[model samples]
Target: MSRVLALLVALAAPWTPLLRAAAARPEHAPCAALALSPAPAPTGRPALQDAPICKKCQSTGRLPCAAHPRSDCLLEDEVLFCSVVADCTACAGAAWVPCTDCDNAPARARIEEKKASVATRRVALEYIDQTMKRPIRKAESKHFVLVWEMDRLKVDKKWLESHELLHLYLKRLEALYDDYCARMQITDKEFAEKFRVFVWQFPQDHHDAGLRFCRQSAKGGVKLMGQTPSYSVCGNKQNFQDDERLHRNIVHSVTHLILSAQRPVAWIGNIKAGWLDEGLAHFFEDRYWDVCDTYCYQEANTNVDFKGGRFRLAVRRMVEEGKFPPTAEVFQQNVDTLTLPMHATAFSYVEFLLNRDAERFNQLVKKLKAKVATRDALREIYGWSVFDFEAQWKSWVLSTYPTK
Candidate 1:
């Protein structure tokens, strides 16, 4: 390791296995009630039988954890389940403490249940924690768990601390999840596991995560695009120069994950379905960044010079010039084998079908997930064979795509 990397790891907080806090419960002797010198005859007034309710916790038997990482964990809806935060020394992921003033059995029991769940989740979701020896920061949204090791981030012309950026990225992931589900009509039950993402500042951590999670040995980024898709990238100046660029990287990778995990729980990237695999990822990249900056041929840096990564006009030009390949030929390729130009045509195919009718396109995806051929699925869902699809898509491109 280089001196710079060594220094950063040294600066990071050390991580150890979750250690249960050990403390003796202090015993308190019950105070003897001062009996009236002579037991007075009971008045007609009702006896004071109940313990006073804790006004601080609103009788809920919990107070917020001390030093709560609320700012980092904030989202539109409350983040009720997070493996990383559940280990907070104060509340143990329940985000509350027992209210000492009142004996609310139900509330205290609920907190205990949450604590137990936290411990279980922490053990199950130890992706980066199990791989990296150094201290790591973590955050989660409904669909994604983020492992962040980058110390600082540049967002909107200003720098944000690591904690601030973690929440921001979590929010971004959820936003994309919402869009993906809405477009595909996918429900929460369709997914098998929460997607895992790791952004590392050092090459070693990135490399280790790539091997462990993605099953690939890559220098830039590696993603496992199956049922429980995971992505790990070395987020340094060489691969991602700025925050906006990094955001693009993740959206592109996560799009691949969502499509693979939607149904049938398999990645079609290698099953002669490269057109949809690469096309859908490019579609989302362009959707958010207004440019398709990177291609997933491999997890390496790409300097796409085709119209500055803006492919709509380029694709239109290809169709008009008769430079585009046959639709059947493109459909026969896999993710790792697609040439740069073929990727552009792939995006156009998805654009043509999804824009014209999303419901039909969704049906087509379900068919594909079931191992049906693209041509067959299209014929069944869109009533078009390969030849028919090619003709219609080219005509649509000529009519709707801008010439500029």
Candidate 2:
């Protein structure tokens, strides 16, 4: 072999096994081969004794946060990154305070280091704190910073305090984030920033947060849609009456924000892509809540029974009775212009596309976000014109949805 060719082959040989190992392991491992190294055989010797640990901290030199009930502090790893814990004067989001009873220098130093890391950035998350003159219950998860101010909520048939509610909502936000990523086939690298969401107890608080974060004032609830989307909601006694209602509202709003922030990073709601925008939002709302009651951007959803919120039967009947609007017309309108019936049909259209195949649905969205016209994107991905989509969606809704 030529000298340079031989050198190239030798250099490439080591990488092939490493690459294959990474492919073999679970997704997103930084170095698969190194991580997969076999364990060494144990030597015939006793393990070293651990250093003296505080009984409370167990040698970690950090104590559990006592600001909350013991049950709230005993969180799983997934729930550990919550902002309520971060906002706590005791733990400061670290989930661990220094062990006061014992003098463990290592634990104290580690706790101090974590506190230092979080301390520098507290101001960015302090808008609500500044307004309230008291800390609001807040939490963080994989893709969102959630500020929740509801005093108490009943979750899973049990009443929970403010901090407990924050942890539960943070967990749900992470789950929603995962579902969105899965449906869109998204990667971490595709996103530029995490979402900022606010769920307030009053309209005034909602309006304040909207002005600060969204730069627009709204009464019921409002969102700043696009890349880095924000949701600010006023959980009044009228619209958001209970836990279930509030959860559904947040889901609907976050769905819009996440879609707008993904990849191409633009809100299509105002650009006559309202069908896809509103449809997908409603689709996720129903997917989670089993019925859709939440509405935004004026679909006449205020106090309207609208099939008692069982949209499937309502949509199926729309097709059976031949009352649904024209596909091309509905697709042409902005989000604010859709009639209530049109919004129902829009959800069905998105559902039909998604139920047909999630990957294809993802491709359609990516195409639309890339500035491709909805007509062309539908044609390229599903081989259908808007008219064809209408016919197919109507057929599928009638066949699949329940008559009752």
Candidate 3:
């Protein structure tokens, strides 16, 4: 019985204080009344010292505190206190949140799009490699690419991929040639020999290489590729969709390319005189008008303006009258003074020369090649001085194509 009584008493002792406190405190007792001391005195200065120390700093004993530092605590009655202390994990004003899974569906889509673009670029590169039989190096700097676009190349939807690829291939080929020349100290003749040999090894390779060289050297590095290789058609597809225009455009462009290759100095880097340059291209290709009609030229009148047409006719009349300029002057005339009228005059002159004396015309071209700028070459070939040739040519043109 004594042992049982002692066990019960030990158990009761543990709970006695809680029961006594509950009974002693009334439910309605005021918290302010229960507080032991009166409110603290106010200090005029900012309650900096009264602020609570950071819990992290207090536990870790590090200065400047971590979470809920002394600098961050707010004071009410000259006593500092923190809204939250134990759970705080960062310095004052810091933001913290639980880790979240980044939703990257949009980002993934963009990455995939970029990959597709890269793949397209690679396809273009491969096409150039197979076509030109040359390894191409891409210009890594964006600046070079931009300059290439402005000064050397342009691309559109019709031939964006194809044209840019060609430009890159050409750049690579030039670089390779320069490198070879530097290493082997080869003369122009030797370089040409090696180049021709490489190109001739395969028949298709030869054709492609020839065309590429012609296209690059001609047109002053302007490359335009379309489904039909017809500029008129390309323009139509881009604007009016007129098929006849397409055919004319093709003839003109192809002629330009061929003549430019044959007479490189006349076209390349001769931007100031594009009129004569263009006239020569037109004159040479005019022979292929029948082919042009077959594609798309009959529906549209592909004639130059009246003034230009008159000029062309006058030039033709001059050739008819045997009063043409020296071959050198003909090639080297400044385009600005040789306006549309002058172009027409020149074209007509060239046409008459070709039609009436094809052999003489051919000989003149050969002579021009030997002495591109010699007055003596002109006098020997045509029996006329430069000034006399000009005056007589003008007189003949005035008689033939009178200004209206």
lDDT of each: 0.74, 0.73, 0.36
TM-score, predicted candidate 2 vs. hidden true structure: 0.78
TM-score of 1: 0.76
Candidate 2 residue spans exceeding 4 A from truth: 1-63, 66-68, 76-93, 97-117, 127-134, 299-301
Q: Estimate each model's TM-score.
A: 0.76, 0.78, 0.33
Q: Per-residue lDDT tens digits of candidate 3, residues 1-404?
A: 23433344456676443333323444523233223332332433212223343454332223322343343322111111111221234422121211123323443344344334434544533543565556432221111111111111233323333224323433443453443233223334421111111112223433344365334221112222211111111132332234333333534544443333332222321433333345544464344342212211122333334323334444555556665444444456543345444455446555545544555654554454444443454577777786765665455556655344
lDDT of 2 by residue, 236-315 (tens): 56666678887888888889998888777888788788888989888988898778777787422266546777888898
Off by over 4 Å in 1: 1-70, 73-77, 80-86, 94-117
Model 2: which residue pairs collide? Answer: 83-139, 83-140, 84-138, 86-93
Q: Is candidate 2 or candidate 3 better by TM-score?
A: 2
Cα lDDT of model 1 by residue, 60-170, tens digit: 566666656544333312443564466678777776777777777777887888777667667666645756765577766668888877878889989998766777788
How badly does each model clash, as a count of residue pairs? 0, 4, 14
The residue pairs found clashing in candidate 1 are none
lDDT of 3: 0.36
Evaluate model 3: give its TM-score: 0.33
Model 2 Cα RMSD, 1 decimal = 10.1
